[model samples]
Target: MVSMFRAASVAFFCVLSFAAAIAQPVKPSATTQGFHSRARLIGGGQQGEHWLAGVEITLDQGFKTYWRTPGDSGLPPRFDWSGSENVASTEIRWPAPKRHEDAAGVAYVYGKQAVIPILVKPKDPAKPVRLALALEYGVCKDICIPANADLSLDLNGADSERNAIEAALVKVPLPQALAAPADLSILSVAPLAGDKPAFTVTIRAPVGTKPALFPEGPENWFFSASHPVDGDHFILTVEEKPKDASGPVSLRLTLVAGDKAIETEVSLDASDLPR
Candidate 1:
């Protein structure tokens, strides 16, 4: 009887321990000194046209964070939303990041506190939307530290916070043309010779300054790394990823001139830019 009672007690203790583990909440590490993160809904709880979700990160006194493209070193921030419902789609609108040089190499980042505005569209506007974000990011000072946070927010109704955030997002700066009155006129698009399909785009710009072109789609693709050929105008040698060739796609080009910014949009066939 004594042995049987002892075995029963051990089984009960095991079940209690498992229950405790399940009850433990997942939260951001408190040991880290310099980094902080928060998420909030912008504008009021009204499902108005669209809702903007804001994610802000503040680095510790001496620490820094990485950009989408961390350059040579540092890990990019990861966001997971497995628990999010009522969210039809999520779009992350990142302000242009800055380049930073360190002992290891140059890195791109948004310093101080960076606010990333996300546009969320709900499938059903009447029902309240609940959003749970699981985010992991890396911060570096003398050494690198990984931090995480589980952020939750609800869309109650239309409000002022949402309006303020939307306003600030609208004022974010974009790239501009280097020359005065520089205009980007799309001349034509045509296919290039190769088994791997590609498109060549001809654009007109003011003489002297070389304007850089970037495509808005395919978040995995980086336009800055692709070199633009200079002649009487600018020509972009672009290749479409296999699955992206179904129909027309909108392309946005940003021309950076010191502190000035200019942007233009064009629509092109997804198959390839026509010759």
Candidate 2:
């Protein structure tokens, strides 16, 4: 009887401890799910037919979010506002990305904060516009967690916060003439044997400026690291198309040269490619 009693006591404590652990809530990491963000209009000139707005995301220290193109791996944010009023289109612009590696692998990130500048155009420019946005994005620290928020705003006047949005907009890359002094252009594109056709692309920029190349396309397509050659040149290995890719694929390019940059795009027919 004594031995049996002792055994029951031990078992009871073990079960109790297990229950306590299982009932404990998960500790929130540097970035947690259902992250916070708000939609606001930054009224200023040069907005033209569209108004400038943003979904401002701020996470705790040590956390990070991804650029429009998250590079090798990471979740790029998505915005769906079809349910909005007087809404015609929403263009989310991205600033330059910071390159780094974590346990998850190499990723391009916007650390701790991301104010995704949105160009909102009204279906009828004469009518007042209201925006309702559904945003889905990823945040990372020790582990990656997907976050979401729904935001809405009415276009009105500029806020004191307008400066921050303007600053972020300034970081948006501008298009340049292929031969422009600050521009970087693709010199050649060659294919490599793969289940999903890949390519080796070469780019040239101004002399003496260290440059990095980022290739963006469908989610399945992946880009490799930049390899340097002699004379303001570099080579990039990229998955030019996604798996079983059928139609034409558009590949966007961003070149980071010192503190300046440029953007361009290339179209390749996936169904038919010779050499």
Candidate 3:
């Protein structure tokens, strides 16, 4: 379902723990059919072929978590991977998130446990691999609490467990393939003259559907509470914080209908209007 929640303001507060004793080795925490995370490594058959590492987070029942862009009031999860070797880089691939509303505000989160897939590339093919991750996420009930964990996995060589994890990861939703045909366009973004800096985003989509709009970054500067003028357009008000003036801004729009979701990225100017 298309959710009315905006993705910019979700609160995902993370506290860092670098002390060796504090930073435990990364491993899959025992599964309890509740909110949890898991990781595995895949690939290494052919020389020069990169290996992909996948991490899955399953949210427990009745509990909701924030999206990369957690709407107005929730904290989005923070991922930190420092002090590791032999790994080239890591990229986070988010599945299509569901929209949720609470007394605090609207948020986009996974209602059930979600498999968040990560791509890991190694520097050398012949050596054994050790992957480490320090992940912190905010779990919300009536009150929200920040959670942290340091997870590790060893990819000595290609194995069945790795292959199964990779296979399952692919089934998770990815941003819509660009090649697929769809009718959605970002029409315009313009500034709203007000005490707080605000902007209106004009979008065009199928006549009767609500499209999910998420601001990419500059987190605290924008509010997710949007005013929809009609089926095809909406106006979003952004706060003009001192820090927002320092960088270029962009917004990601996720439009969903039935089981299909399409994402479009739009660049915004310093004024919060379309560039």
Candidate 4:
């Protein structure tokens, strides 16, 4: 079993709450949006062993944004920090995402607004770190629109926004060891009959529980909708194993039932499935 924690890749986190985990940058940078965004930094501008940097994004009413795993269709958020100076690296800490269902389709997005906390590490502890962010994200309602923001911050000392940053950080999912809850278990995994080749995930959960299985891993992997088999069981149709696959592909599954959710990772191989 592997931890579901996904380190920040490149600049920002599109995953549930990676933005709060390791999103690189220093200080609090915010700018007025010309379109549907007004993003700025909160509780930053400090030099420490690790700075708790955060971004607060507000969208126009009725507009929604996407999560790291957008389920069937949606755009994930992206960040670029190439414009920064005296920066070592950053990671995005993600909070659990909400499941959204609308006429367009099912999408994973934040509620009305999101306060994403990022963990930043500076190259030189003595000099102030400068952070520049070029953020690209999508907001949708009846139609989808792509938006961008240019925000930068200079870190010298801590701002007085710690309450908000600390609050948002609490929503981030913590690393959990693999466990088989008494009421639910993943039964089996195998390839399905298809020309393109896809696999099926079978699981058994207590009756009447609304079960949802979400896939998290490689960007190329695509997971389909979950199909109910019975009150005690269901199945997930996932992307086909690449025929030219070299090594095993690592994947994670989030099982949400009622208010409780379990996050676990396993390789999509026969050996990894439960007997």
Candidate 5:
């Protein structure tokens, strides 16, 4: 079930408030429009030394956006924050993406809406920070389109949208062990002996729970989306590799099951073929 297609090329183009004391609507930054979607910047006030923020994207029904690593095809969303003031650095924490298949290929994406949580570090803690974002992403349904938006927001320690940002943050896959839990976890990942490079991943989860796995490797190495082979076993095929990619490979695997997800890094040596 390894589906492969020519990668689609994307060209660049192009939330929220607190109560009246609790009933007031959470107001996001000015909205920027794109194809069939809208984007804005959200603030979660200040959390410790870092400022909590988000880039929220809302799309029309049946539309979807790509993840940081857009599996087989589709362009991953790009973020630029160089337009900000008093912002030293920012880290975009990605939520666990679901598997999306279309005529084009298999991609990891978010459907209908995506709230991408960002952690901003200020250059000076005592001063206010202005966060800016220039985002370019791909939206797809029957056809794919490139979309862009520019959004900005000044953080003044407002907690209007803190809950929303925190909710999205909970979806971010945290680093975990291969066998993190007894009910849901990856059992093993071993190289498959074949002309083309491949690996088989075994996962464990409660019965009837469908687990999805996404594998990411070093630059120049393209690992296809994990294809479920049998009960709890999935196959990851390597579609392309650099000429010099013949050494032990390190892969970041994100496995999602039900409401639980984990990101684990595994090292695979070509010589460790399954018997």
Candidate 6:
């Protein structure tokens, strides 16, 4: 009888501990300080079977960081998660960034603070996930400086920062089909015939809303920032191309206007001239 009672007590305590873990929120990782910035790992615990996580970076006054494709200059943030434990895969979701112009040229960047949301899938949902990040990025103002941060957090429960993570996610550009929205979208893309290859991208945004276009392509291809031809028309000239590059290049374009933004992929063929 005593043996059965002891077994029941052990089982009850195990259940209680597991329930507590699910109910409580995990603490954020220690802040890692670098040049003009500080970073840390935050979590939203488990949503469904996957975990919600983030790399929160705070920048000093007048310092900014680059996006996935930094454009003319500056290095994008590189994340290394080899030090993590029980993690199957991780995806970093980037929020919409603003266009920054410096002597170097046009670049996409985030100002003040950047909370990059991460979607983490664990090897086992029932077990704890230890997330570790070795982050390397650049901070620029008068001068650009490379920065590094080693951040980590153990995700075993929900966190208060989940609301923050959700807010950041709201800023991420929604992927849309070409010409999807009637109010704001890519109206047309026309190939420009010239000694130097170029293309014209026409965008439509609500009246009085100035729109900005960001174009990204293969690493070998370099494109000039969109130049406004008129209210809704912009031209992007090809600055450089690979020695053996061909036409019909696939371009990833991000369109931003005020608080609204959308990302879409478009293909431009050198032969597809205006009708």
Residues 1-275 of candidate 5: C-alpha lDDT, one tens digit per residue? 32334422422121011111233223334578777998878889888889999888899988999899987667688888888999988988999999987676789999887899999999999898998776778888876676667678999988788888999888888787876666767888776778777778888867777888888988877787555667688888777766554558788999887787788888876444331
| TM-scores for all predictions | 0.55, 0.70, 0.69, 0.71, 0.87, 0.85
Sum up the clashes in candidate 5: 11
**Full-model lDDT, candidate 2:** 0.64
Runs of candidate 2 with Cα error greater than 4 angstroms are 1-46, 177-209, 227-231, 239-249, 267-275
Q: What is the C-alpha local distance difference test score of each model?
A: 0.54, 0.64, 0.56, 0.63, 0.78, 0.79
Show the lowest summed lDDT stretch of 10 residues, model 2: 37-46
lDDT tens string, model 3, 152-238?
Answer: 666565544455455545544445433345565556666777765666766656666666655555544555546356665566665
Question: Taking the tens digit of each residue's C-alpha lDDT, what string does model 1 give over 15-76?
Answer: 64356446546653312232453333343444456676766677656667765555445556
Off by over 4 Å in 5: 1-29, 270-275
Q: Judged by lDDT relative to the true structure, which candidate is superior, 3 or 4?
A: 4
Cα error, candidate 1, residue 219 (Å)? 10
Ranking by TM-score: 5, 6, 4, 2, 3, 1
Instruction: Rank by lDDT, highest first.
Output: 6, 5, 2, 4, 3, 1
Q: Taking the tens digit of each residue's C-alpha lDDT, what string does model 2 give over 1-275?
A: 32343355446545543554455354322122354322233433227788777767777788788788766555677777875788788888888777767554567888876676778888888887777765666667765555555566667655555677788887777775444443466565666565544566667766677767777776565556554566445444553334476677777777776666677777767677432
Stretches of candidate 6 exceeding 4 Å from the true structure: 1-29, 270-275
TM-score winner, 4 or 6: 6
Candidate 5 local Cα displacement, residue 97, angstroms: 0.4
Flag the better candidate by lDDT, 2 or 4: 2
After superposing candidate 3 on the true structure, give the runs of residues whose Cα lies further than 4 Å from its correct spot.
Answer: 1-48, 83-85, 156-181, 192-196, 206-209, 225-229, 243-249, 252-254, 271-275
lDDT for position 261 in model 2: 64
Error of 6 at 234 (Å): 1.6
